[model samples]
Target: MNRHLDTFADSIIAGKRLSEGEAAELSATSGTDAFALFLAASRIKEHFLGTGIDLCSIINAKSGRCPENCAFCAQSAHHATDSPVYPLVDEERIVACAKEAEAAGSHCYGIVTSGTTIRKGEELDRICRAVRRIRETTSIAPSCSLGIIDQETAVTLREAGVETYHHNLETARSFFPSICTTHDYEDDVETVRVAKRAGLTVCCGGIFGLGETAAQRIELAMTLRDLDVDSIPLNFLNPIEGTRLARADLITPLECLKTIALFRLILPEKKIAVCGGRERNLRDLQSWIFFAGASGTMIGNYLTTTGRPAEDDWQMLKDLELTAGSCRE
Candidate 1:
């Protein structure tokens, strides 16, 4: 174990990316040394990103009524989860959420909607207007996760001051079909490509605990590494009641921490956030992620899932003495 840690330390110090086998081995590490792996990841994170946490908050601008069939998602029309079905919020309401996020010390505000596509129309226009309003009114960087978009729509978003576009590819190509059927994995790749072409920073990631294997998770990270994603939001599946995957119990806190550490080792310089299921799965040990090379965390409610309140997240940061990202203060 010590010899492997030495090799891992050497690889990170030399700025060399890990092989898939090495990553798989890192995922399989056990016991007290798991904490040692976390320490190594933290060292790499410090060398690159410092102690600043990329604190972000999201508002589900549009919820439910999604047309896709992602088995783990509550918003999917194929499921019967009792989530609020609402149209896109008005520009004023959206702007209000941005204000709230800013007041809470979030460096970025993400406007997320559940949909297959957000093409040019009143829906797109409203979201663009909201982004413009947020940019004009607050210092918070406005971001969107409205699903697949064309080049023209991407350009419109960039022009409206949308700084980042999030579109998670979910999992590796080999494991994607097992999670969702309404959309092909390549379509997601193209969306990120279009967003990049339109001059927007891309934030892409996936959910664990969908019963995917460790090798599959490593493959997903390799794909994100290839994309050069600016931010990776790792979500643990919450298995909300009534969703098709509700009965699935494929993840634990230790496994989730290992994944985060592995992500830090892989995407060392990118902002890696421990998002979603932190409140549920991480249980009492959530704060330890800062030591495990996690440079960011998502606060506030998630789409169709409840999150710890902003005050509790703030207190957590206070307890850890962590600061917001470089841009925040």
Candidate 2:
């Protein structure tokens, strides 16, 4: 074991955040005891957030027919995976799903649409109305993941009572082109900036297991740090059949733990969540993600894939002796 690893772990244990160089070292570490790192990260999570899990759920309010050619996405028009192309869900349906998410112990319900941007007019109008209705009728915070958003749209959503805006960076700047040619990484950064400028909490994170080298993962984390994102949703790639990256191997649970632990060390006070693809990639060891400094999670189904049921996730929280509560439920 590297002596520096223990020293880095100790800094976190002592309630001191890691320096950039220290965070780089931890993210670059491989072949170490991942569980040991998880233990250290669990201490960090417990210190900052206690044993509470901020549970949220997401619905693909609008799906398929995305113009972007993101190689890992099942919803991209470039992929042959069967997906339904639908206009945004009606406001009534959006509100109803928020109610269901509340009943399932999720405090936040995300409205995700597959596209390059959520531009002006009617689509934005319907979304805003839905957000307003949810705020008035339920306790759930309406989080939006409607692709690239400008400053004005961000303000509009904020005024409509939308709380957080999720725009994932998806990969390191250098490695981004290999993943998606249709949109660049800087575009994603600007959207986060817009969201924050509008006084909305920015939930941003990248997916691992996209064939990125360890250094690229660290680069992505440092980028997130620079942006001062409020929430980080760490996703492991769940390679869907027919997508270009479908044959990509699953990221081991150990790798996932290491990433989460490093993220905890890097963003000591921000919300770090175990998001999409945890179930398939983490297998039976998903419980340890919380122990590895994940303070939150997307509890129900993901955008194009089925997630573990809400009851199962709730039971996992109980087993871990963690309290689960949110705006809705």
The residue pairs in collision within model 2 are none
Candidate 2: regions farther than 4 A off: 1-6, 13-17, 28-32, 325-329
Could you tell me the TM-score of candidate 1? 0.97
lDDT of 1 by residue, 1-329 (tens): 85677678668867898888889888889998898888888988888889888889889988898999998999888889898889888889999999998998888899998889875789899998888889888999999999988999999999999999999998888999999998899999999999999999999999999988999999999999998888899999998787889899857788889999999898888888989898788899899888888998888888877888889988988998987774332
Per-model TM-score, in order, reads 0.97, 0.95
Q: How far does residue 130 in candidate 1 sit from its true spot (Å)?
A: 1.1
Q: lDDT: which candidate is best?
A: 1
- Candidate 1 achieves a global lDDT of 0.88
